[model samples]
Target chain A: MSSSSQINKRRTKPAEVRIDELMSAAQTLFLEKGVEATTISEIIARAGVAKGTFYHYFESKQHIIEALKKQYIEFFIGVLDNAVRQCAADDWVSQFKVWIATNVQTYLETYPVHDIVFGVHHHERKNSEKNMMLEQLLQILVGGEQAGIWSLGQARLTALLIYCGVHGVADEAIANQLENTADFSEQIALQYLKMLGHGELNK
Target chain B: MSSSSQINKRRTKPAEVRIDELMSAAQTLFLEKGVEATTISEIIARAGVAKGTFYHYFESKQHIIEALKKQYIEFFIGVLDNAVRQCAADDWVSQFKVWIATNVQTYLETYPVHDIVFGVHHHERKNSEKNMMLEQLLQILVGGEQAGIWSLGQARLTALLIYCGVHGVADEAIANQLENTADFSEQIALQYLKMLGHGELNK
Candidate 1:
């Protein structure tokens, strides 16, 4: 074939790359115009993929959002896991602090997608994803309790409080548009640690 | 006029009573069938009021939800206020405890209505109603600080944490289908108090 004809041939990108392109395009559009406003055709157009290719991956626009939601949750939990792993296995204090701090930082950074996914789902009495995150947090609380760093009389309840409390305050921080979330995250960590009767309060 | 004729004369209820009837009926319907499923005609029919009465009180379904939301917030804050008032004026600790206890108690008691009114509102960047409730909690925190029950370095943030933490745990309690929320509420209050460096954790 001539050089020009060769250049015009369809380039076969990997399935993962194409899926990423579609998801990235969908995320951008969803964030820009909202989930309700964006459509599948727009996503396919934005992704520069054929309709068949789009269908090969996601069943619908909502399916893309579901995929994004799963990615977002995994991304968030992964961040916490990495933060916690930075400390020694026995140093549950650091693990707990890093968990809270990373949680605040990552959530503030990623809440737009968070809002897009979670905001649409109404008051779900039972959210498995939330429960999974709580399980991760409980590990930190229970680990600390076992190590004698603090007494967690009600470990699961305490985890729920800390997990929800962190998320709630992060929402507040986002609302106020605080410039430095790290300091606020640290403040939250210390306060929760104090609640756990592990860390000393600031004088 | 004959006695039967006089008794049959259309008994015009007071405006306050009429408005209460309309709101009560609307609340019940909204809870039973959800906001979208409940209709203005049903509300009027349930209230035994003419269509004009509902129109006079609320412009639309959304308008009724707004009214119900305001009433719900007031009812909630009122419960906390009454609980706090039961203690001595100078006893900020009791005031604070009552505030948390009443908050958890009232939230668990009334979350269905709360969800109905609030479930549809998107993740708001700023919620004035939430701010108002936070202000009420701040009073107790600052009051206790002035009384020297415990030092609150970051009183506003502390209040936010405590407020969010309490709500979060109550949600957990509800999710777990706990029969008695009092013990859980007390547990939450004591953990927060420990965070405040005032209450002792269970041994």
Candidate 2:
């Protein structure tokens, strides 16, 4: 093939790779400046993509922000899921501890990006992202209950309390710039386990 | 006295009353038409005060917003404090329970105003308002610990968990428009009490 044809072929990259490049570029600019300051032209320029390609994937800055939020939630949930899965299938308590630890650790490490994507919707009460995480916790709570490790008076309410409580405590940890999170996470897990009626573990 | 003098005398209201009138007018407008849409001129019009009076107390809309936030926090803290005070002095568990219940009840009743004042600053990491509320909770936790009502592995951390947890769950309650908050609050208090090592009460 001629050199011109080869150059054209390189420009026609896979759609997923193009979309990832655009999102990564937008995220970098959003961090450097802010969502309001960063524009589509800057994102396209940073990603080395054509203007048409950027428009093809995202209609506007707000559209891209929603896409980023969805992507961030998926990654956050995946990290928590993976951490819980490492424990023995029936080891519900261990599964929970790992979930809490991973959540705090991941959130602390990734909160800057998280703040970028989620800052606007932080006060949204009925958020789907929140429900998605709550569902994950509910599964664990129900599992532990099923195995006779613990019992719940109201599983969904209990899940909301735990989910929101852990998240709130993690926000405090971030504020305090807490060190020694392993011990911190352990203490949190212990307290929550006690709340779940697994006080026998305290012995 | 002349007609002009009579009108002047009417304008010379107490500073506290004038300020309260201004805040109330602004709050009414904020709820009716969001903060961004409400103007200082409209506020003065609603308060039946001159533009000079509005500017004398507040430099700009943003200044008034900050003032409103401080006022809101003070009122919120006062409400929680009053509810807790109604319990027996040494009844630490009842105090804590009342604190949680009142927090849910008051927040549900006044959250529209709360949202108007606090919406912008919701994500502030090290907010003084949050610290003030947290301090109130720490006092109860410390009191309970001293009385041997319960124990704490990490007093401040435990306080953060409970305070943030209760606040988060209350936000959920607001979202759900929960009607039976008395029972909801009791369940929350029981779970948190268990976390505080008062599991004996569960029997």
Candidate 3:
């Protein structure tokens, strides 16, 4: 490879690689000892990186975690957005199935955002920015509801259930409760949404 | 009345008074300094009780906090249960109004629980023995679906939506965004639920 090619690979790879590595460390520590018990020094140590290198990427400990959370919510919203687009091309049942596939794919991809994202507690008043997105989420959901393509009865409630099912996957994934014998997380989430949207068992 | 009679009156007050006082102290410090920074000493100091006195009523920090959480969740579930019970005597609209009333009452009364229960970084994941009663909630909702007493669409989704309205109240109340000036919180919740259940914009 040329010298420029070598530099390009090294530069692009480290940032993404370091982020994943740091996130894995945080996830491990956060699980073993809740978020309160884990610290920045421990995270850097586990990632085998200098403290300054960690700081180069993150503003604060909670900052990185919050970033992780924001990324997760954003990704799931993308999944939903994609589902909405897919549903536009088909009917409700088929739409729900595509949604399930998208949800599972997004979750199983291991983007290293799960630790502080979907399962994040919403009670802290400091998480104002994140909570703002939820309100906007309401706006988007309401728009979808009015569109007749979505078939929303209670937009807010439907959002919560759908979020809960997604959150359930994260919670289970974190605690490692997902049984290895079956890969039903995606199907279960689909069933949950189908139950909410129509409540009809398989025809 | 004599001093003795006044002392007797004080003595006869409910046990929850002391608990409420302790929880108030813990909640304030927990919000200010977080669960890790807030200590038993701080809680007792704020409550103006002896350290031993604190120990007399509670086992440890986690125990007391769990007690507070349990009481809060129970109080919430109790309100929902009572409302659902009362629903048997009324039309579906009135029943939904009653249910929403319970949601508003619980959210208003336990503002701290709303603070602690949501948005916090740390959540203790113990097996929830208390959630068993939720089956009762499911039964009541499913029964309504079977009776065609609901909107003739997805009853499961309807239940989820109504619950979301309840959950949304916490976030709304916490953010001080609930401007139920023309409508009371209960009334707003009821209207939201009615809209979800029947897709109605009317009384």
lDDT of each: 0.83, 0.87, 0.57
Listed in order, the DockQ scores are 0.57, 0.62, 0.20
State the lDDT of candidate 3 residue by residue for B1-203, as single tens digits: 67775686676644456677888898888878877788899999998877876887898888777776776677777777777677655355555555556666666666666566433434333235223333544465555555555543444434443454455544555566554522555445434443344433232
TM-score of 3: 0.62
Model 1 misplacement above 4 A: A1-15, A200-203, B1-14, B200-203
lDDT digits (tens) for residues A1-203 of candidate 3:
57775686765665667888887788778767877789999999999999987898888878777766765677676766666575554354454545544554565554344544534554543354345435544554455345443455555545544444443444434444443412454444344444333433222
Instruction: Put down candidate 2 lDDT per residue, A1-203, tens digits, no spaces.
Output: 67875676677876778889999999999999988899899999999999999999999988888888889999999999988989999999999899899999999999888988888765688889889998999888999989989878878878888887788888888988997689989998988888887875434
lDDT, residue A125, model 2: 84
The list of candidate 2 runs beyond 4 A from truth reads A1-11, A201-203, B1-11, B201-203
| Residue pairs that clash (backbone atoms under 3 angstroms), model 1 | none
Which lDDT tens digits does candidate 2 get at residues B163-202? 8778888888889888889999999898888888786543
lDDT of residue A112 for candidate 2: 84
CAPRI category for model 3 = incorrect
The residue pairs found clashing in candidate 3 are: A69-A117, A121-B119, A122-B119, A123-B118, A123-B119, A124-B119
Computed on C-alpha atoms, the DockQ of candidate 3 is 0.20
Residue A25 in candidate 2 has what lDDT? 95
